[model samples]
Target: MNGPSLAIRQRSLGDLTAEFPLFPPLTRGCPKSSTDEIAYPLEVGYDYARVDPGLFDQTPGTDIARWSPLLPPLAAPTLGEGGTPLVEFEGIHFKDESRNPTWSHKDRLNRVTVSAALAAGAPGVVVASSGNHGASAAAYAARAGLRAIVLTSADSPPAVQAFARAYGARVVSVPAEARWPLLREVVDRLGYHPVSNQTVTHTGHPFGPEGYKTIAYELFLQLGQAPAAVFTPTGYAELLYGVWKGFVELKLLGLTGTTPRMFACEPAADGPHARALATGAPAAIVETFPSAAYGIAGPVGGHRGVLAVRDSGGEAVLVTDEEMRLAQRDLAGQGLWQELSGAAGVAGYRKLRREFGGPVVCVGTSSGFKDLGVGAQTYPVLEHPTLDDLRA
Candidate 1:
């Protein structure tokens, strides 16, 4: 769908300006102070408070004393990511993100990041993505009237390439290892804003995950309480971190009594988060291998993934390719045809269903088109066999 679409039992986060719990405060990782920095002239008409980290993070105990411009309140036509379907299945709930503009949950991050780019007066945006993120960035940039450059793997799925081009992004194909440095140069040399990430490590942009907070907010509003557990398919683990942080902030603000246990579902070929949780370390020292679920084939979780798992009383689980394929079939039975990685959450729920009591949400991250290259296929030639010819 070209426009926004959400298929949930209708509900809303009414009066986004109304008093809710303050965002939970967390330590800001900014530098001590600016030294040897010359003052530059400021631009007018843009809200001066837009650049403050608090505008995005909104930590607890924050005092909004000044007239800070908030994100335009969540309204209709959300591009199908945040207000996804919260359907019931044998008492378990599913948050289906396939209905988004780009057919993935990445739309949430790109929406928030694109807004930040526009607010900051950026000329355009650049990103390095295998699929969903690039399409999402491109779509949002088109909406915002900014140029978008997508540095993607040469081997990206054709459907994804078509999606990127359809949204007006300049698609640049490159090797996996070569893409990052090129993206950095694009930002430092070309002045195009880096929306994906630029830190030496996998520290993504400050405002990117802010978009993910809406998922948790929707969960509470939809169910009228926190779930007993929540599971997500993991790659960089940004969504996992966002959901956990959102709930923690909610608890701090007295919006919820407690946070649910978050879980990461990884493809067994490269179960980095699972390994990291097993080792009890902040970082997982491993390498990713190619798999059917290309979206979740990362070597390890990003900077904040481990912390999210630890803080939310969560653990990571791995599903084999065969199991994931079976999950795809199972979800199809539920009338949800998702990508291979999209089935990871359902696979996790199937494994751990007996342990949980209250409502559980399994996040379906993307549409099946994202991984159309990997799967079983069969074809038959025209035989023209009539009624009784094949019955014997």
Candidate 2:
């Protein structure tokens, strides 16, 4: 029950040369490589040698707090965020994150970020997301009794926006370009803790992805070892990197012999991760087009994502809207109605078209209810007729 963190410091992902203390978390990006104009993300560093080997012997519990030693200091109470099932569907493994409190994997990230806000004694948290991130931030901030501000675009999923507002968050609709700037002002001027990305190249909260590492721990427990490959639905590749980091920690602890290959699944319309890898950049920006899988169609890629694919010897695979649609339907056939973006992993896995010697996992990030237009259909009423009409 005592899951105190062993986190010591943070290292920059830009060049891995910059270092900073863990506490008073670097809400901004790496100071060495990041300026007001250019930004680079940082990774949390833990005193892994000090980690108790007995942690592996214990049953991986229902929430992220079970492995807090390997992560940053957790400051928020759990809303029952981890322990998602890794189910076999369509001849492959599917990590179902929809069972989380927010019906999305973002719950895991928020559990840590909101804790950062509470630890900093910040009054509220600010996030620039129109999807799961916004909703999850609102939910967790409310649970922690902190005010939340969600800045979204007008075209975001209606249900997702409703989720933020329903949680009593102050949701504001603004043009897409204005979100980050507004978020900056909220963080600096208004003194609100930013639970989302504030950097230009998508370095989210330093402690947020630490929350996502729990998924890998659960997978290791469920599968009895590391899988051969993990396919993640990536916007900034935070989940991809976090999962990889967990396995890396396991290997460092002399548990697993090797780590899984991390495959980042992104929308073809906006292949930030894929393009960033191709260019060998820490991060990159690309023009984006709206896709039904809106969650992973991010314009900016992150250093965390670049590190994940490259170090894991994995590649970024772009999935089309049609491909994801088929994958979504495929999951639905297996009784998992995931959001369109949630199907990116399976879509990427199928697109890879190579046989792996071991088990492969595709992450389903959210429920179908989080997608656009879930409850908007209006049905036509049938006219009253004779009882024989019913039989007909």
Top TM-score prediction, candidate number: 2
**Which 10-residue window of candidate 1 scores lowest in summed lDDT?**
38-47
User: Which lDDT value does model 1 have at 372?
Assistant: 57
Q: CA shift at 113, candidate 1, in angstroms?
A: 0.5
Off by over 4 Å in 2: 35-38, 383-392
Q: Give the per-residue lDDT digits (tens) of candidate 1, residues 101-132.
A: 77888888787667656656678889988889
lDDT of 2 by residue, 147-241 (tens): 99999999998888999999999999999999999999988899899988878788888888888888888889889989999999999888998
- The 10-residue segment of model 2 with minimum total lDDT is 56-65
Per-prediction CA RMSD (Å): 9.8, 1.8
Best candidate, lDDT: 2
TM-score between model 1 and native: 0.78
Report the lDDT of model 2 for residue 369.
95
C-alpha root-mean-square deviation, candidate 2: 1.8
Give the local distance difference test score of model 2.
Answer: 0.88
Clashing pairs in 1: 23-59, 23-60, 24-60, 25-60
